[model samples]
Target: MNAVTRLLRDLVAIPSVNPRLLGPDVETPAEEPVAEYLSVLAKKHGLDVSRQAVLPGRRNLLVRLKPSGKVKKRILLAPHMDVVPADDSQFKPSISNGRLYGRGACDTKGCIAAYFHALCQIAKYKQRLQHTEIIFLGLIDEEHLQSGSRAYARNGPKADLAIVGEPTRLQIITAHKGDFWWQLKVVGKAAHGATPHLGKSAVHQMARTVEILLTEYNDSLKEKQHPLLGSPTINIGVIQGGTQPNIVPDTCSIDIDRRTLPGETENTVRKEILDVLKPHGLKPDFLDLRGVPCDALETNPALPLVQRFMKVARRRRTLGADFFTDASPLASAGIPAILYGPGDIAQAHTSEEWIDLTQLEQATEVVKRFLQEVES
Candidate 1:
């Protein structure tokens, strides 16, 4: 097997499922194993490695390769190490018809394999490069709240440009929609189900709120559309209230997902939500909680690094993704970042996830070429 294939197989075989998807019975629930594995691989390749602990027993691993001459630019290869939960059988990677099947085989492990191989080759040919710094960051909790990337962006050691590892079918992504979430809660008096008139129902009030969001808010969002990203959108993901059918619930809470466009911030979204609530008499108390807030990415196509990557990869089209990525946080921190990798985003988080070996090879070649091009 090739080095990239072997690396991907090893990564797939190890169960580094995100803790949020599992119960408390798991002994090791974070990306510690995968982080350590990549760390050892970097050391084996004679590179400098370090870790920034994001959570207890979980860390974001960074491996670096320094050039011989003065560094002109720094490029980061960021791929999340954590995968969504999977069954025990899924942990054992199996190859069939030139495809590797496993939980994270396509989502990002394929990028890890491709990036690592290219990094190894670049380090081997370090003397050929004039000036450039290459870094591979194996981030944790990307499938969750992206806390790893958040911490990395907030803390020290920033980069000039970055290639965030996500399944883009080997395409160069210049823009993608933003992801933000809020929790709406309605509190009311509780009473017996038989005497419904004695107390108000929070669920009823919440239903009206949901209708307003589903209709007015979404309609208003459609008017403000992004060029690459179609329109700002919202989805009611989860709703929980009431203990049983026989009792009036005192509280109803729902999670709302808002996909924002460029020029939108947490405060802006908050105000928009409040405006939607005001007409219906719903107060700010309804939207009292917020989830991991991230911005949409809109990199200038004329930027040197972006143009170099597109020219090196030989891809013509510039597109946007409906999903979110770690690039948003990095870009918010003043670093030019784009999403590019092997495989398709469709296979991510699927039950029988797999990545095409052909695409993987193509992506590997692209990474090598981009690194050399940017460095030169």
Candidate 2:
């Protein structure tokens, strides 16, 4: 097996499931094992390594390749370390049909392996990198709260450009949608089952609120569309109301997952919802489920570095991703970021997650070449 494929297999074999995905009493190392493994590997290669404490036991690992000469430009290679909850069998990685199968195989671990392989290859000619410094950041808690990236953004150095890695089929992604979660609750007086007219039904009012959001509010969102990301989207994932069939529901609530495009803010979105609901005399309580909104990423494709990277990847046009990534937080911190990596996102978070070996090798080579070019 090639070096990149071997590294990916080893990584998959180590279970680094996000702690939030597990039960409270469940004993798991979370991302510690993977962070230690990468730390040892970095030290073996004589690279600078450090850790950024994110949570009580979780930390983000940093492996750096400093230039021999003065540092003029800084490039960050960021790939998340945490994976979604998986069965024990999924942790034992296996290779078959030119694919590596395991948890986080395509979701992100492939990106971590490919980026590390490329960094190691570039370390051979350190003298050539006179002015550019490359850093490999293994972020934690990306599957849950994204605390790792948030901590790095607040404490990490300012980077000229950041290459956020994910399963993108090796495409250069310049834009992606953001996620905003909210819960709307409608309140009403409880009434007896027999006398339904005595007290108002909150569930019935919530039904109207949901209808407006699904129809009129949804249609309005379609009118404002982003070229690459398309239109914003809203999904009523959950609804809770009433205790029993007879008792009138005093309170009804719905959890909403709104995918926001560029230029869309929490205030604007809330205002839009209010505008639609107020006309119908419906004023539900609004609560921000996600304390901090995940903003959309829209890096200028015209930047010199971006253009050069696209040229290296041999892509004439940039693409957009519907899902959010660590790129947004870094970008919001003033660093231009983009997503690129091997494998398909369809295989992410699946029962049988796997990555294509051919794409993995290609991604390593592409990243290596890009780093060399940036150095020169």
Candidate 3:
């Protein structure tokens, strides 16, 4: 098998499922095995390697390759090592009809393999090029709280530009929507269902709140449009209320997902939504409890490094993704960041997840060429 194929297979074989957050049925954290495996790979490749362990065994592994002399520009390549929970039936890595099937294959592990293989080739052909440094960051908890990326951003080597690894189908993604993830709780009086007049149903209140939000806030969001990203969108991902059919619900909770644009922040979106419900006499508690907050990655497409990458890869056009990535923190730190890698986002997080080998090969070639262009 090719080096890229072998690397992908090995990565897929290692289960790195993130543990449930303080649940009664919690599983052991899955980020460690991937970290341990990458550590050995870094040593094998003779690259300078280090780790920033967040939990006991889980760590964000960083591997760096440097030129012999003084450097100019630093390019950061980041790929998450963790995967969302896989179906018990599809956890094993299998190949059929030129596609590699497994969890995280297209979501990120494919990008991991592509980046590593390209770096291996670069190490083999070490020469005096323009690039000062190339750093590969295999991060943890991206599928969970984004703790690894957040930690890396707090204490990371400064770089001129960052290329976050995700399934972008070999396209150079210049922008994507940010996120305002929040939990909302609505309260009401509980009583027997038979006495409808005595009890105010929290579920009814929740329905009204949702209607007001969808009618007022949702339409307003559509007015602000991004060139490539289009307009912001909102989805009520989860909602729960009454305990039993006979009981009037005392409280109901909902999870709202708000996609943000370039000029938007979480505070602005949160306030606007709450304001819409004011007329209805609704007062719901909004909490930003999710440890991982999604901030948008806004990068200038005209950066020298980005231009070189586009030219080397012969990219015809640029686009934006609706998915959130590690690029946010990097961009927040004033470094130019882009989400670009192989595989399609559509195939991500699916039971039959797979990536085309041909696409993987093409992506590897692009990475090699892009590195050569930057370094040479």
Q: Lowest lDDT 10-mer window, candidate 2? A: 121-130
TM-score of 3: 0.90
* Per-residue lDDT value at 220 in model 2: 89
lDDT of 2 at 3: 91
The 10-residue segment with the lowest total lDDT in model 1: 283-292
Candidate 2 C-alpha lDDT tens digits along 1-376: 9899999999999999998888777767889999899889888888899999989888999999998889899999999999999899999999999999999999899999999989987775553588888999999989888898899999998898999989999999999999889999999989898888888899999999999999999998899888899999999999999998888889999999999998888888888899999999999988989797699999999999998899899999999999989999999999999999999999999999999999999999989989989744
Tens-digit lDDT track for model 1 on 270-336?
A: 7898898898888635453434667899888788888888888897767889888998888888888
Clashing pairs in 2: none
Best by TM-score: 2
The reply for model 1, stretches above 4 Å from the true place, is 190-199, 242-250, 284-291
lDDT of 1 at 281: 86
lDDT of 3 by residue, 219-284 (tens): 887898889889999888999899998889999989988888888877787788778888889989
Q: What is the C-alpha lDDT of each candidate?
A: 0.85, 0.92, 0.82
TM-score of each: 0.92, 0.98, 0.90
Backbone N/Cα/C clashes per model: 0, 0, 1
Is 1 or 3 the stronger prediction by lDDT? 1
Candidate 2, superposed: residue stretches over 4 Å from native = none
Candidate 3, residue 15: CA error in Å? 1.9
